[model samples]
Target: MTAMEANTDEGVIDAHHHVWDLSVRDQEWITGPEVAPLRRDFLLADLKPEARASGVTATVLVQTIDIPEETPEFLAVAADSDLVAGVVGWTDLTSPDVTRALAALRERPGGEYLVGIRHQVQGESDPRWLVRPDVLRGLAAVAEAGLVYDLVVRPHQLAAAHEAARLLPRLTFVLDHAGKPPIASGELRPWADAVRLLASLPNTVCKLSGMVTEADRDRWSVEDLRPYADTVLDAFGPRRLMFGSDWPVCRLAATYAEVIDAARELTAALQPAERREVFTRTALRTYGMTFTGSQAPQEAPCA
Candidate 1:
């Protein structure tokens, strides 16, 4: 009844995973000895086998950088692959013409696959960056374009994220990595309160991803991850949450399959239907993904 992959017969949708080609572009963030292993290319071809083995029939390809070129590149990659059903690309949220920029991206190749937009807000020094006037306007534009906004921010930034979600009720804010709680420290204060605040809003959702890297990379266990997972599950509930592998980047702590296993174990207490919402339905609904000729959206929930 618990701790198994494919909780839903519809198959799993990795709501957050990334792909990059070093030859196409340099990942400037992939620096230092700790993350150096991620410097190589992690293409769809490389993900397909792993995803297939893990029962991931669909995935949302997310942006890795804030560069303009990366979105188009990701859209093109989604268009070419059957595994990637949606894309959460990056665009400037501080630009006055961010609406046009989003429109222009939608008109590009594979634009139909554009489900959301993201920015590396975690790198920003300001704790309230998400509530800035210029940024709020851009987030409005994303809502206008019918796309969700993925938040990649530090724990301290969750407060601004909370206000931003409150102000922009029209825009669906997908919190990546549960605001990256300090799992390694086993401290979940302000972080837990902030998450509860954001989850109070109906428009906000969370991704059950990236816990492995946030925890002790070498000695982490499902027990270490349980409380944080329980926090989001208690706050957002499974319906407002979805599963994501945070792959390649997750390689820093766990393999793609290992990440999936951890998520399954973390959610072992939920009823079958609720588990379905986390492992499949929420992602499909959140991203508005459809598989024209794929084996996704299978007939029933897991027995």
Candidate 2:
């Protein structure tokens, strides 16, 4: 059966998405014409209505840059917003003072909303950057702080991500965008194999996101993303797979609603309970999130 059609009545936890202000800091990564649509600010006010209309009851605000200040700013945003449930901020993972930095972030006004940490591993030239001694030590610190580590790496970096998960068995490593498969090329050999390898590790999870931009953006459809989506579903299953809009960035290819619709279409075959796990349970468990009042109609017990 196809997944239930997108509806606002269903409680959803958008496991991935971002909000940024150009006035605060140059997204330096937002350069070039292809991403020109995202050149402006994407504050909570802009996303709140779009996400709410799309059935997103809670969301994880992911970090866009490797800056130390960005996380605190995101925590503040989460603290103030009703839609944002968690913040996955970035910090210097290779620094000896990583623990101190994390503690300082936790003490901030909205620090309780900080759920995880992420770095742009995809931009790092070193394939084994995740296993580097310094990075591993910092990852241990992240685990100690009870925070999940988000891996934003390319296909080539999946092996290192697997090894990093192996090395730090305690750290929950979330593979962003399914390690960014080569959907546009429609080649799944290594990407599929690597995703399965990482999914084999019990400590890891994968996000069903960013496929539109990774495919033939101008002409992509749910069919173009099915194979990669199927790979993660078969490997991680719905319980470990979660939905992420990869918004603003996804705006480069499709609108926020389109992304959500495509994801629903991709997971159409799953049972209602399984789909719920992907849309809500998995994120809440992976991020250790809880909802209050009517944010989510039925709250799943926190992990």
Worst 10 residues of 2 by lDDT: 1-10
> Which stretches of candidate 2 lie above 4 Å from their native place?
1-9, 293-303
TM-score each candidate.
Answer: 0.94, 0.94
lDDT of each: 0.86, 0.86
lDDT of 1 at 222: 92
For residues 1-303, what per-residue lDDT tens digits would candidate 1 score against the true structure? 111122234468889999888898889999999998898999999999998888887788899988998999888888777677888998898898898999999899888888899999999999998898999999999999999999999989998999999999999999999999999999989899999999999999999999999999989999999999999999999899999999989999999988998888888778877887898888877777544433545422332
In Å, residue 192's CA in model 1 sits off its true spot by 0.6
What 10-residue stretch in candidate 1 is worst by lDDT?
1-10
